[model samples]
Target: MTATVLTIAGSDSGGGAGIQADLKTVSALGAYGASVITAITAQNTRAVTAVHPVPPEVIAAQVAAVLDDIEVHAIKIGMLGGPALVDCVAEAIAGFAGAVVLDPVMVAKSGDVLLPDDAVDALARRLVPRATLLTPNLPEAARLLRDEAAGDGAAMQDQGHRLRALGAGAVLMKGGHGGGPTCTDWLVTDQGAQPFTAPRIATANTHGTGCSLSSAIAAGLAQGMALADAVGRAHLWLHGAIRAADGMRIGQGHGPVHHFHELWA
Candidate 1:
């Protein structure tokens, strides 16, 4: 039987990020993909012009419907637009036995804010605790920590430890915004901290990196890979996607990473 991974996120009409990216990444990584859309965005590679959030009840219903019928092995969550939806999702996934990878998607690549300010507290309190792994980029980690600390090596380690205290099984602090030749990701768990580094690929086509990475990790976990190994494999796959992105000219602005780069060529 194929492993099934569920993605709870928003929808991007341009198919770059959110639900579209999550599903694509899951499929590319050889996992069955399922989705529960929390919101819809009129967005392309250029900008997010508008957002339409799914009602809280509707979001809850979708979660219930999927969980009741399917035997999901892992779940990837992103972009809860409001507090109500956050609460709803938290309640729905309270007892899931499988791994849950939460990507706290606060801002978009275009500098547009995807999460509401008021919803941050709810996400921190309700959803963070339920996540098996929490993946936050530099800015999102800073916001979660509520500190203006620099993204230095020591600071990143401290941030990962602090975030791990918020009830997640582990925390992966991404170093994409650290402004260096190499991007380093720190993974902190009960055992110890593990850092994964890769040479930075300079490109404008990084629109859906966060979504893709989290979903890829979920796919790995669904296939029964250990947390550290799952993260390691996801890092490698995401790096390849970033490198392959230069070949595709999808939009006028920042384009998306090629999720199926391995299969295509």
Candidate 2:
């Protein structure tokens, strides 16, 4: 059977991030993707000008529609509009018994906030416990913990474990925001912290990176890869996508990473 992954996220008009990115990534990785739009954004590579939340009841309906007919093996969630939507999603997915990759999408690539400030608590308190994997960049991790972003490896390790305590099965602390020749992502589990590092490619076009990565991991999980292996494969794939980003020349501002880099070449 073909693996199936459902993405519950916002619709990005730019075709770069959010639902667009998630679906593209799932398809590129040879998985079937089903999506439920939780919000809609008037956004592009430059900025997000406006956002409108999808009603909680409607969001729940979408969740039910997908889960009812499709045997979804994994789920990727991003950019919940606020606390209410967070609660809606949490309650809706309560019975699902598959890998849930939650990318706590707080901000966009263009520096615009995708999720509001108040929604952080709801996400941490409600959805964190339900996630099979929590993928948070430094800023988001700090926001979730109400602490400073990790400044080094030790701090990253500490924060990863702390996030794991919040009830996620595992937490992956992403280091893209840090300055270094090599970017290292730490995956924290009950066993210990495992580091996955790749040489940081110098690229200005990293749009949709987090979304695509989380979706890719979901794709792997849907195809039956273990959590650690899924994360590692997604990390390597995203590195190539970022490396090939400039080849497309997407927009005047930050362009999107190449979701189909391998296939296009």
| Local accuracy of candidate 2 as per-residue lDDT tens digits, 1-265 | 9899999999999999999999999999999999999999999899999999999999999999999999999999999979999999999999999999999999999898777777999999999999999999999999999999999989999999999989999999999999889999999999999999999999889999999999999999999999899999999999999999999999888899999999995
**Candidate 1, TM-score vs. the true structure?**
0.98
Clashing pairs in 2: none
Off by over 4 Å in 2: none
lDDT against the true structure, per candidate, is 0.93, 0.95
Each candidate structure's TM-score, on Cα atoms with residue i matched to residue i, is 0.98, 0.99
Tell me the deviation in Å of residue 63 in model 2. Answer: 0.4
Question: For residues 24-63, could you state the per-residue lDDT of candidate 1 as single tens digits?
Answer: 9999999999899999999999899999999988998899
User: Relative to the unseen true structure, what is the C-alpha lDDT of residue 10 in candidate 1, on a scale of 0 to 100?
Assistant: 98
Error of 2 at 77 (Å): 0.5
lDDT score, candidate 1, position 54: 97
Q: 239, model 1: CA deviation in Å?
A: 0.2
